[model samples]
Target: MSPYYVSYKSDGTLVSGPGSITAIGNQTGASSYNNRTSGYLWCPTARDFTVGSGGNKGTTADLATRTASICYMRGLKERVEIQTSSGAPWQWRRICFRFRGNIYGASGQNSQSGNYQTHIETSNGYRRLLLQFTDTSPAGNQVENALTALIFRGLPGTDDWYDYMNAPLDPTRIDVCYDKTSTISSGNTSGKVFRKNFWMPMNKNLVYDDDEAGGTESSTYYSMHGKQGMGDYYVIDFFKAGLGTTSSDVLVFEPQSTLYWHEK
Candidate 1:
């Protein structure tokens, strides 16, 4: 039997239910919906990004499972540390999400903010998923010690027309990097940039390097990969081992593939 589909009207009212709708048509003029509640499903608590922490810090382990109804990361105090494996020591990195949506951030009018969210239209027809960070310590710090969050809104299961079956599964395939030539930079200098020409499959366990090792070219960088047909939410913990540092300025890039999985 075909799965039940639900959606909402533009007026914030529930339009369809389990038995009220069948297949959606062009004239439906309704948003897609999944009958799942919003909350943390995998990681009940925030995973540590520090090395050897035994939590979800790297791409090897599946952090995507802990994704809340909206996936996010929070740093309680100024001492909280997070880093990507490829980042320099004692440097701040930015966290980035690779999904397609109208990007929004809590930091400022720009995209680089301690707290942010993304509204990805799933391959399915539903548009009700919300990924948000509820609590952030040091309420007014904003700069020195700020909390970062990433929210994803989409269908839950893989049965939708554009489910995980066609989405890029490799996490490393989505490259997040620093744009500035120097290691010690501040502000948008460390914003997220995309390298679309350099695309690789994230369906592996080990780190994949597209270019030769130690090459003096942009193509020599390496990335962590993810698995195909996996969960919808993917989380990456950032950690740093220096004092007075926050790794929150990292870029996330994904190769443009012909895979028609992002839209349903």
Candidate 2:
């Protein structure tokens, strides 16, 4: 049994399965035009997301900054056609990453914090996906910023799972961890501390750890097999919120895929 499950509807009653609904386009709200054309939607507001800045330290108030990171795990079975506004069709899949952790920067010395962030390739082939993290202080002199560890496939539209595999030593358990520490001080005053940890799962059997230096690393192969199953269609797992510490939070994105017309 998969540790994660995909559910539709607000009640979490419409559990998805192998031979479930495959078509997209449906009414998501009472308003006629409010119909949802996306194949699926999963919003994980229940989980707290955070991003780390760097290491832990302080004095001049410019210690380390706070940044947000994302971790994603996906199980795919088939391939779906990704269409663009120019009427271009390409093969693609949706990989969702669920995040849970603290948003605000850690306090005091020797403190740590972390969050999870996920990404996927749109039909258009644009690789960079911009995500927002929380603001430090509205009226403070502290320097703050956000960071994330991105894992992806280098060879786009390829079908080899081994290249993208992060084979975990243990076949039964797979774990990913990211930690950041911040230190701040003037020209020899004192130092403060800030730190954070973020983690998620890559299937046990499909685990592959390339152990590259930077976070913006991409795998050369696919982690899971691409067979004819439920994985071939559009899939929505959960929705993640930004790291804004206040109500002025906003999640922005430019739609990359062209909308398709489905005959109900």
Q: Give the alpha-carbon lDDT of every model.
A: 0.22, 0.21
Stretches of model 2 off by over 4 angstroms after superposition: 1-4, 7-81, 87-144, 148-201, 204-264
**Compared with the true structure, what per-residue lDDT tens digits does model 2 show for residues 121-235?**
2222112122212122212312112111122322212352221112112212112232122111221222212122212222323222222448644331122223211111111
lDDT agreement of model 1 with the native: 0.22
Candidate 2's TM-score reads: 0.18
lDDT of 2 at 236: 31
For candidate 1, lDDT tens digit of each residue in 1-264? 111112211111222221111111211111122211111011111112222223322232332222111222221111111222223222222233332211232443322122332112223222221232321222443321222222322332334323211222233333332111113222332432222121112221222222333643112111212332222222222212222223332222111111111100
lDDT, candidate 2, residue 26? 23
Stretches of model 1 off by over 4 angstroms after superposition: 1-118, 122-200, 204-228, 233-264
